[model samples]
Target: MYTLNANEAKTKFGAMLMKVQSEPVEIIKNGSPVAVVVSLDEYNKIEQLKMELVKSRFENIDESDLVDGKTFREELNAGKYD
Candidate 1:
């Protein structure tokens, strides 16, 4: 990862775009971190990992613990979880 100030990033936008293809670049402004630039492939990989995490967490759910939408809404309105 590489850090670049706002002015440097603006002046070297093309180079920043190229560098992000190889590694993430952190943009900072006024000495505080602002944003991270990443390649499309890296972004997709991160999204895939997030999806896999969600799937793994839900895969072990028991059918008996499931509730219908209407029942859930009713319970929510009744403050059952409060």
Candidate 2:
């Protein structure tokens, strides 16, 4: 990972764009990270993986085992899944 200040990112936008093709660049504002620049391929791959993970997790949610938010919290607090 590489980090660049706001001014550095604006002045060197083109260079950063090229660099992001190979790896991510974190843009910092006031010494705090605010944004990430990544290649389209990398961004797409991340989105696809996130979608797959959500789908897999939802697959375990049985409609027949449905519970309200309060009941769900109670069950979690009771460590039923464990």
How does each model score on lDDT?
0.96, 0.94
Give one digit per residue, the lDDT tens place, for model 1 in 1-82. 8999999999999999999999999999999999999999999999999999999989999998799999999999999989
Per-residue lDDT value at 58 in model 1: 94
The weakest ten consecutive residues by lDDT in model 2 span: 58-67
RMSD of 2: 4.1
The positional error of residue 73 in candidate 1, measured at the CA in angstroms, is 8.4
Q: Over the stretch 30-65, how does candidate 2's per-residue lDDT look in tens digits? A: 989999999999999999999999999888988887
Worst 10 residues of 1 by lDDT: 57-66
Candidate 2 ranges with C-alpha deviation above 4 Å:
67-82
Off by over 4 Å in 1: 63-82
Residue pairs in steric clash, candidate 2?
none
Cand. 1 TM to true fold = 0.76
Per candidate, the number of residue pairs that clash is 0, 0
